[model samples]
Target: MTYLVNNPADFVDESIDGFVAANSNLVRRVPGGVVRATRTPPGQVAVVIGGGSGHYPAFAGLVGQGLAHGAAMGNVFASPSAQQIYSVAKAAASDSGVLLSFGNYAGDVLNFGIAEERLKAEGIPCRCFAVTDDICSGPADKASERRGIAGDLTVFRAAALAAAEGKSLDEVYEFASHANDRTRSFGVAFSGCTLPGASQPLFTVPKGRMGVGMGIHGEQGIEEVDMPSASDLADMLVDRLLDERPDGAASPRVGVMLNGLGSVKYEELFVLYKRVSERLEAAGLTLVQPEVGELVTSFEMAGVSLTLFWLDDALEQAWTAPATTPAYCRGGVALEGEPRDDADLAAAHEEETPDASEDSKSDAAGMLAVIETIQAKIEAEAEDLGKLDAISGDGDHGIGMDTGARAALSAARRAVEKGCGAGTVLMRAGDAWANEAGGTSGALWGLGLRSVGACIGDENSVAAPVVAEGVVEATDAIMRLGGAEIGDKTMLDSMKPFSDKLAEEVKAGTPLRQAWRRAAEASQQAADATANLAPKKGRAKNHSDKSIGHADPGAISFAMIVSAVADTLESLHEDAA
Candidate 1:
């Protein structure tokens, strides 16, 4: 349990503030995260890596010489918003290009993928490679689906080295992708990790038992068994990795990292690595640059993960590159010269106010009211939504939703006050929600809202048919962006139903209020029906069956918002009448 925190919600923000202060010599704070205080070589490509907070050294701590040029830090245990990623990447990009690297998770994929596109659109050469290195998450054939664990170190290192060597963006991306394909990681836990101010751990382990195949974020392990001796545990970790060695290597040269998740001390790690090293040698494998300490970590998870980077000649050279950072280092001490050039660090462009009609601005005021109503509803149901998520997920959904609703509401109100149109107000609100919430739900909601904004032009008339068409566009856009099907047991379950019903009702020429009511009813039914479904993504993917009896928190929240929007519409009607 983390006791140092003043408020759980403020943890991520405060930590980043403190981190930049402490590492002032090595890193400087940017809009979304930290960039290296040390300048990169001119015309060199920038390798920007990031993910959630809590996993320290992994993200911000590694932002310095010979490693990540910058990191897009997010909230604890959540993927960074696309807005955050875009901001960091824009700041981090040099004249050459940018290559984005992160662990393979749904939210990270969605957010980073979008950022890559946005960067490309702005003529900044961009590419992305997700590290899928966890061996236990999926079969070897489906290894691409595996969630990245500590192997992130290996992949990120290669990318940074490639970038530092002044490689082109394509070359850096290739090196990063190659490292990911050659890396594999597996972890075990004696217990689980407690989030800041949380009453309990994300998941629990039975006393006197250890969970094999545990994840860094307190994902429950696949197998639970009696605790083993240090030597036995080492053997289990080594043998599991050996069974999944890279092809075409009878005696592969490997770089090994035995990473402590959080609580395991360096002495314990050294002891475990002793046994691990002995076994690898006995199997006639050559170990190069074996790292035995904490690399990536959960808040205080009493667990460890072993990352094996099967190195070829080129990769071995890259892995051995000189690096200086707050945490890990290699080769020799390097002097920091300067931070990134402010002139070269591109900031986000100023948003232009599109011409909006007075009637559209009035509709924007209505959107603000709708946002307020949704926020209140989400605030009231926060605990219940969190409880629902806790059963099969990390249980952060309620807090995430509340955070997003507050930010969205605040942004919408500001836009309305500025006399912006409904589309601009909704777009700004969506970006705020995603940036503040910082998760899968946040990313999807941001995309959904933006889709609606795109369909409803700033200068266009706001009508029931246009609003219904916006819903249709939102449905298609979110489905494409999130890659979730109707039965995937996500917010889409409610969203698709609402969108379909709204479009149908509007087509039938029904009153806007009545059509919205019918759609809200459809959303409610779909959300309730989620109780019979199972999760196919995010934290619940591994133990999806456990979610069978509970409605998805995301779906439930979607239903609640739809109902609140209906009330907002009804209130609008009443005022007009």
Candidate 2:
């Protein structure tokens, strides 16, 4: 049921026959399962990328003008015979010579290694390049132990470029090797993929979870983490790529790829990219180019892989070169959507805004620092938060909070660098919090930031009354947008009471510090009360009584934040007085 194929025994050959038949103009079948381009361009060093047949658009589908010159095919998820390797190597080589690139596997090593010797004997200069980019496969002492996943694209592209440039056999070999060195890939599977015609999946990761570092053919992953949002999953994959990347490289331009295994939606791949871009930016890694689609796949697998390439000038140039094939092609860099100037947005504002001042800068920094501290506190309690969410929700609050907090800090830093006013700085930071933090948390957190921004306008320093107004405004937005009011067992239970108390204290002419302290205390009290209330929204809403004993994570988070805000205000007031 997992795989869709006519016959298990005829799977590999049938697939190869179909591919060659479909693209007779570009490829021709060679002896021993290898396929070569019908016409090899002279003076171009040829790259023949290959592997077991199941991972499509990989060793085989890549054969074209700027990609592979040929592909040595093997049985389904099995290594190709040595004859298969030799045929492709000899057939694809031209005056520019030939380079053999494949995933790093034991059988591939022996077969391709022998193929090289045979090519040399026939007076054909054939060199070998093995891709070892799957970071999930093994540790440093044993990098060779890893399997090749989506990182194969980087190697192929690099080799394609080197060959296209008319590089000699040694140069092309080195370029391919460099691509392997610069590349790193990680994969996660929601479910295992079935080999063609197989009734059962090669492996199974339990439902609602992901197997990180899973192999292309249903091998076990390093660990299984509860299924996270698209962004969270994307970040986990990107972070691993960033960490495992080779050093001493100029231009940390990444060729980010979100590869869908067989059945995932192409649009979902873009969603994956949206998260990937945020994570890459957060880590100070510049993405020179990004690719999103199914570049490689197992039959009917629900999974995605991220491949990062550290590009040099040559690699960048080659990747942009013209190329076309059956499943992939060079569509010139798609235009980034129309530009919007933030300055124009600010200018269009109907309200009068205050000029930036040293005082405003200080206030902005102080508030952000408070948020940063609150983020740290929340991060410390992530496990507990996740456990709570798991009980009646998606169990992502802990992860979401950590991401939102960091996003806020980064946004704050950018605002500070731009000499923005306190309100604008906080507004931008909040936007980052919403946009970068994935899922429902992003929506709520973003609304909170917008609410604060709406009230502050151009204020340089917060007076007791303005601070109270901002809190009240933020509370209102949370209520309207989140649709959760007091006793609804959500953040509003804490934020609403906190805002009212703050406003009352401010109107009574209480000192800002005292008003904040009262607000913080009231917020805490309300947050604790949520444990007794039935849930009313999101997945928690489904568990009406089940969520009764667990305090709403949003409420606890709100209380912790307000307490930090109160502490920050106290510090600011002391400095002013």
Candidate 3:
């Protein structure tokens, strides 16, 4: 368990501040994360690595001269927001291009992929590679479905080395992908990791038992077995990895990583490595440089994982390259003084919005009140929502909703008070929602709000039919952005039906408030219906059967917010009438 914490809510933020301060010589603080303090050679492809916090040396600890140029840190066990990813990437970029890499998790994929698109849109070249190396997460044939664990180090190191050599983004990406293909990792856990401030760990292991093939993010292991001795555990890990060695390897030269996940100590890892090394040698496989320590870690997870990185000539050279970072420093390399401090790491400016007429601005104020209502409803149901998510997914939905709603409310209030138009207010709120929540739900909500605002425009008070159209546009945008269909047991399940019902009622000449009320009923019904659905997207994919009796948190949250909005709209319309 994580014992040293003041406020669990502020754990990550406080940790980052202290971490940057401690490693100031190697890294400097940026708004979204940290970038190397040492200057990079101009035209070097910047390697930006990141994911949720709590994995120390895997990310920020690896940022320095020859490793990652920057790390886009996020919430503990959550993906960094797209804005955060963009901020770090932009800060790290230096004319050539930016290559983003992270573990292949749903939140990280959505957030990082969006940031990459935004960077490209702004003419800053960006490419992303997700490290999928844990063999236990999926079948051998479905390697792409695997989660990245201890193997993140191998892929990120290879990519960063290629980038440090001033290789093009394409070459760097290929190197990373190759490294991912060659790397395979498996883990055993004696206990689960506890997040800061959480009373219980994400999962548990019975005393004298071990969880095999566990995920780093407190994802419960696929199988459980009787606890074994250090040598036995080591043999198990080594044998499992050996069973799925990369095909067509002429030589058995491999780089091995014995990773301690949080509570596991160096003594334990080195002891286990003793047996692991013996097993490899007994199997006639030649071991190259072996790193036996915590390269990546979870917070207070009593477990260890072994990564086998099959090496070729190029990979061997890359692996042996001297890279100096705060945590993993090797041979000396030339370094110029730090470049000029970034001018725009944190966005101090407001987003641009369309001009609004007086009536439109007034309506935006009304919308603000409606959003407040929605936020209150979310706040009230946050814990329940999280419980719903925990049934089949990471128990983060409640926290994510609270974070996004609060952020959106804050942004919307500021925009409305500044006399911004409705479109501007909604757009700003959407960005805040995505930036603060930092998950799949966050991205979907962001896209939905932005789409609605884009449809509404800024010149006039939104009519019922126009509002219905905006809702439909939001539904379409969310579907396109998240790749989730109506039956995917996502927010789209509720939102699509609500938008459709609203559109149908508005077309039939129903009053806007009444149309919204009618549509909200459909939304609630759809949310309730999700209890019977097995999730077809996100983290719930592997645990689809577990979700059969629980409604999707996203769908429930969307239904509640829309219902609140309907109430607010009905009250406002009655006052106007």
The TM-scores, one per candidate, come to: 0.95, 0.56, 0.93
Please list the residue runs of candidate 1 whose C-alpha ends up more than 4 Å from where it truly belongs after superposition: 38-42, 333-338, 341-346, 349-354, 570-577
Model 1 TM-score is 0.95
Model 2 misplacement above 4 A = 1-4, 33-38, 331-577
Q: Rank order by TM-score, top first?
A: 1, 3, 2
lDDT of 3 by residue, 1-577 (tens): 7789998878888988999899877788887788888655678889999998998886899998778899998888888888888888888887888999999887888788778978998898889898999998889998887898889888878998898777988999999998898999999899988888888889899999999988888888888999999988887888888899889666779998899988888988888999999999998888988998888898889999999999999888877788888899767775554554646344444455457888678778877887788789989999998888888888899999899999999999988988887777787888889888887888778767877877777787767767889889888766765667878888889999999999999999888888888999999999999999888778787788899988888989999988888778843323222
For candidate 2, the TM-score is 0.56
Global lDDT of each candidate: 0.85, 0.71, 0.84
In candidate 3, which residue ranges exceed 4 Å CA deviation? Answer: 342-355, 464-466, 503-511, 570-577
User: What RMSD does each model have against the real structure?
Assistant: 2.3, 23.6, 2.5
Model 1 pairs in collision: 37-339
The alpha-carbon lDDT assigned to residue 394 of candidate 1 equals: 80
lDDT of 2 at 214: 71
List, in order, the clash count of every candidate structure: 1, 0, 0
Question: Which candidate wins on TM-score?
Answer: 1
Which is the leading candidate under lDDT? Answer: 1
The all-Cα superposition gives candidate 2 an RMSD in Å to the true structure of 23.6
